[model samples]
Target: MTTNMTTKTLYLLCSAAPPVFDVAHVVEDAQARGWDVCLGLTPTAAHWLSGSLDGLAALTGHAVRWQYKLPGEPDVWPPADALLFAPATFNSVNAWALGLTDRFVVGVAAEAIGKGTPVVAMPCTNSAIAAHPQFDQSLAVLRTAGVELLYGESGFTPGPAGLDTPPHFPWQLALDAVDRHPTAQA
Candidate 1:
């Protein structure tokens, strides 16, 4: 039987890094699939990925959010169907892993997880950081909490035995993951 599923909303949380190229493509793809996409960018990330937000907004038909709050206004939180953190920087990953939510992206992610929103994180970093013991522990914690970690290219590189590899990005993998999630259709 085929299921008629509609994407309600998707939150794209980004961090500052060159890997952000992957994120822009993913956001565009998500919008193409009829998902409402909102971008929550870290302060540093905003500077790097500034121009891309206009393109994202054009494609998604929604404004991207960077600061925690609008100028002189209270917080306005957007409801999201799924949260995808692409090119998740090492800093943000560590912060979220240890329950720190100082930044808007990490804070929103924490809130989403607390409310049972499905989360897909595409962590992009060097091999050394990816293989760090602390990073592994953080991944374990997130996994235990039901967060799906889409470890980036580093995870797929052939190396040690018994290592699992993640599929590539472009929001297709994220959409597939969401399709498998019980809440995505709801």
Candidate 2:
């Protein structure tokens, strides 16, 4: 299949969260807006989608990347005009803010911020996890680095327990954050 060079490239980073399974919503939404979507998954997220890799690859028209490519292998995806990570977990958020590049998802997020790429991380966690002092510090660090985080009202908020699914995942808010980013306007 031929890729349209003119289409805006969006890297949708998927981490382990309940909404991870519903990624098709975000992917389809980005596609509807004329974005050429590239998916980067955390190892756990990759496992979650393990059974459906083919369908997801066909959906994005690109490989589902979960690991760093070897030095000799050419990158299949283009430089991202925007990066959006949804269902970002507590560990992933803190790791990214702390400059930990051990995982593919956090690595890309940290490097993207350094490259001045527009990035948005919508974390999915309960209040129990949000109450962690380190989490607040992590969010501050990420915000200081120009990483737009979707939280609070109109964004992602910690939901109560006893529910099989999170009440909402704020996928559109992440998309909106990307849309509002000055560099992403292209």
Expressed as tens digits, the lDDT of each residue in 94-169 for candidate 2 is: 8998888999878988899989999888988888878999999999999899888888785798976555568878
Q: Return the TM-score for each candidate structure.
A: 0.79, 0.94
Q: Cα lDDT for residue 27, model 2?
A: 85
C-alpha RMSD values across all candidates? 5.8, 1.6
Q: How many angstroms is residue 71 displaced in model 2 relative to the true structure, after the best TM-score fit?
A: 2.2
Q: Which residue ranges in model 1 land beyond 4 Å of their true spot? A: 1-7, 70-77, 152-171
Which tens-of-lDDT digit does each residue in 1-186 have in candidate 1? 001254477788888856565665666566566566777888888887777768766655666677677588954435888888866777888899899988989989888889999898877666655677888888788888888876644232223334333233344665666656666654
Cand. 2 TM to true fold: 0.94
